[model samples]
Target: EEKIPGVYGIDTRALTKLLREKGSLLGKITFEGGEDIEFHDPNQENLIAKVSTKEIVEYGSGDKTVVLVDCGTKYNIIRCLLRLGVKVVFVPWDYDFTQMEYDGLFISNGPGSPEFAEITVEHIRKAMEIGKPICGICMGNQLLCKAAGAKVYKLKYGHRSHNQPVRLVGTEKCYITSQNHGFAVDNSTIPSEWEPHFINMNDGTNEGIRHKTKPFFSAQFHPEASSGPKDTEFIFEEFVNLL
Candidate 1:
């Protein structure tokens, strides 16, 4: 009798090393009998449509209304916003929310490459046209960069740990942060109107960006820190203050 083949285990340590050296790439797994199956790259598709909230969802009853572009937003992002005494209205990633009255615009975290979320990028560009205070997290950061004419690229091994350290730009202050993403904004591509706000201490990668005189900013880390440290929880407070 022939034995069936299956994965016994994965060498995560070696995989991590390889990813670090080669950056993120498109690949696939196949069984011996399924060797002819094709591998499709999810990054090339419109990921926002699959991940965004179809219907508008509201939370909290604070005076300020924050229009949250739902790109598979994490629950903690809403939780933190509610805790800040602000009203959150979660809209689809491709929704044209310019007609809606709001105090701020927030872009949420999600999966796949930010380039695939072209509609969300356009919405952000519209928000910028209206001069709304904007804040983003995780994938949100990359989308904001795209809206600002900046470029994003896949990171080698990315920042996917809880205790990643990030230092505030032009400051000696460092904060332990929670991160989970495979792409990063290219620091060299940021326009003159914006500046690098935070940097990863371990690898010197761009961790955040901020507009020079506009109330626009974004972080690659999860400041809400659902299952991680709260060292950067003040980021939420800062966003609220911007409004």
Candidate 2:
């Protein structure tokens, strides 16, 4: 148990059913004679700032260099890129990477609202101006959409499972992807130059988006999988090839 503190006597199965049916909820736990604590809503906090690296970190020694915005990134993303032999320059969520030289710009997946990373959105917009290859995953998708002038909204219950089905924009080809997001990009608000690239088959939410003519794209699902399916691992190769 790691000796961690926990509240007991609650029916976890019923709680799970309630969350599934009523969407996400904010609650606080207390015990008799314990000091009262205010309810905490994680979504309202800048979780990226808490999880992102405070200093720049470099990994691998490949020819192609990738500037990865560490908005609470998963290590597997670096592992996947390293496997493809690309040099990854990891930076914090708000660090400016436009001045530095890199073949591509990667916005890493994160937690919380995209509004907290407005600086990141601005940086991505500037990077887009230079036409550098850009790719993002999960929360990365929301930030990318915001950078492109699209709207992002919180999901009801959110896609927090390993087996989420997403279909290509105009094709029947579908891939089972790993997802854990509480927000999604609004496809209708996407600019004309950018189109919805993928659609969630379950809820018809925007799963991904891409520029019409530029090498900019993002996915709301994890291609790295980590603890989930590997059906979308090809996404990494596709982004790397662009670089």
Say which candidate scores most in lDDT.
Answer: 2
lDDT of 2 by residue, 13-46 (tens): 9999998899998898787898999888897789
Model 1 residue 7 distance off true place after TM-score fit, in angstroms? 2.6
Which ranges in model 1 have alpha carbons more than 4 Å from their true place?
1-6, 9-21, 25-29, 32-40
Candidate 2: residue pairs that collide = none
lDDT of each: 0.90, 0.92
User: Considering summed lDDT, which 10 consecutive residues are worst modelled in model 2?
Assistant: 1-10
Candidate 2 stretches greater than 4 Å from native? 1-21
lDDT of 2 at 15: 97
* Candidate 1 positional error at 44, Å: 2.6
Q: How many backbone clashes does candidate 2 have?
A: 0
Q: TM-score for all predictions?
A: 0.89, 0.93
* Clashes found in each candidate (C-alpha, N, C closer than 3 A): 0, 0
Q: How many clashes does the backbone of model 1 have?
A: 0
lDDT of 1 by residue, 68-114 (tens): 98998989999999999999999998889888999999999998888
